[model samples]
Target: MKLNVYADKMSQPSRAVVFFCKVNGIDYEEIKVHIPKGQHLTPEFEGILFFFLFDEAINLMQKLPAIADGRFKLFESHAILIYLACAFPGVADHWYPADVFKRSKIHSVLDWHHSNLRRGAAPYVFNTTIAPILGRPLNPQAAAEAEIILSSSLSKLESFWLKGNGRFLLGGNQPSIADLSLVCELMQLEVLDEKDRTRLLGPHKKVQQWIENTRNATNPHFDEVHRVIMLAKERQQHQRLKAAKNEGGSNMKKPLVSRM
Candidate 1:
């Protein structure tokens, strides 16, 4: 069977997976999972995981961005990426290179990304931007706290990882999987109002440049994959505008009833 990549583009990791697959000319079919419709939890997803015997950590979660290669099933974007890097022929060496120490270093950055950058960015973006679009109240307090963590994470990446000579992470001229994953994660911030987004990212100038560098390196594929995110941002902006207009209309005073 051909490789099957199950993904929802709205998901950061999912976008990373799809981007990698597309950019590398890997032959795979992308099965779209409409996450907002709760399709990820459907019986169809569970049906494919009949052989769910991978380690507990990688056990199929019936989540977006999983892959099925023959009888083998895998979840977790990082695991899938590593698997793809090794399993497929014609993948570029720079992505998950043959050099063991470099591969380990990339893994180190990915590990930190899950716990730090993703942790902070996901909830922070949700609270400040996505929550309201989903009909949940935006939580300013949570966003504020999340910003502190995200800012710290940015500082760490800028200071520790990207502080050296490379245009990409870990001093590499070409991007690695870590670079793609982290940049995709940061794409969620595009949903924020310009002022808010700029304020948050403003301090980390190097990180900003790194992002552009990654985008440029990936070129057409990167922008094409991220069109989903850009569309999402547009939809959210429209929703906000409509909501504001409706609120204003409701606030306008009606003519008084004289007989009351």
Candidate 2:
């Protein structure tokens, strides 16, 4: 039976799952769930067991990047990646190595990512880019705190994880699922203004190189999965420019009206 994946490419986990499927040649049907439109809230989605929902109001226990094969279902991107690696024949070992120690190291990075890198990175991007676009209240204090945490997380990512003389995370020459997961999380920052994105990522040369390396390793599949995000970022930039131009025009007209 073919696998069914319900995902939105705008989401990091969803992109990761899509990338994995494409790179590994896994046969799956892509079901696009438009989160902004509230499609996931409908009865059709709710009927599915283990549906990967991505609402902030939902409990944290709910999983995302979910998959289904027949009646069986699974969620949690990390678990799903490992499952794919293990279940599918001909999957490369570097993804989820059979060696107990190597596998444990990969597990360690994945576990650490949630609370550290993901916590800092995802919130920062949401606060800076998505919140403003959605007309949600922007919390400067929260964004500031998230940036500090994100900076520290990047430091650790550089000084510890990628410190060894290896191209990828955990000192592996090839990219692993952990690399994909974390890279996708960091990629969220791309939606920010170019200045902010550059400031946040500039100091971390190694991290930047690792991201490039991972993309190269995954090849056309990585870029293909990321097309949605790339388009979104472009649209965001256009919107910002338009808004600024309107603001400037309004400011200029206000003086003329006041003088009259």
Candidate 3:
């Protein structure tokens, strides 16, 4: 069965799915949920009638039995990743393990994703960036407080989770879903201004090193994920340079006027 993923460009969950598929050589088709265009909110894309039941899209998946059968199928990311790893043996060893304890450890990462990381980080970043662009201004104080909380959590993750005595998150051999989930979340830090990136990710040398390593690695895809990130970063820098030039030009005019 071809895995179908519904995602927006900047979404961390979506990126994790894409990264996993690419790294594992899993075949899938993507259905874009372009939040900027208000596409995710549409009946065609977001409607429970059209797709699987996720926590965010649970109501929509209620009607489709073929898609909603809890037996012989799983919709949650952790469940799906485990299912995929077991089904595709040649994929990789680091993702999920046959060992019961090792497998349970991997599942814990997913559980943490829903409760801690998503709760702490996702909303703060979304409200800070996407909300305003979508015409909703979340309270500034709430956003700031959320960032601090999220950053603190990130610091702990750096010290303990991502840096957990392995070359990757699962252990020293390679990476697993745990690594992907953490990396995907770290990718969101790139959206912040320079100061925020330094404050949030810079102090975590291991986390920063892993991210740099992944960006340098290869993935089999028509469009690789990090390539898109690099292009976006370059574009943002260009815009900043243009704005600086205009400000400089205005300052030059003021000096000339004063001389006159």
Q: On residues 28-110, what C-alpha lDDT tens digit does candidate 2 reach at each position?
A: 99877766655566655564433444322221244457777665567788888998899888789998999999999999999
Each model's TM-score?
A: 0.88, 0.90, 0.77
Model 3 Cα lDDT, one tens digit per residue, 99-165? 7898787787778767766676777766655466568886678777777778777776677666655
Q: What's the lDDT for residue 131 in model 1? A: 80
Q: Give a tens-digit lDDT track for model 1, residues 1-260.
A: 87878888989999999999988989888878777666677765455444342333222465668887876777889988999989987999999999989999999999999889998898899998888555789899998888888989989989998988799999999999999999999999998887888988898988999999999999899999999999988987888799989999999998788995
What TM-score would candidate 1 get against the native? 0.88
User: How should the candidates be ordered by lDDT, best one leading?
Assistant: 1, 2, 3
**Clash totals, every prediction:** 0, 0, 4
Distance from true location, Cα of 94 in model 2, Å: 0.5
Winning candidate number (lDDT) = 1
Better candidate by TM-score, 1 or 2: 2
Candidate 3: segments with Cα more than 4 A from true spot: 46-74, 163-165, 216-223, 242-260
TM-score leaderboard ranking: 2, 1, 3
Scanning candidate 2 in windows of ten residues, the lowest lDDT window is 52-61
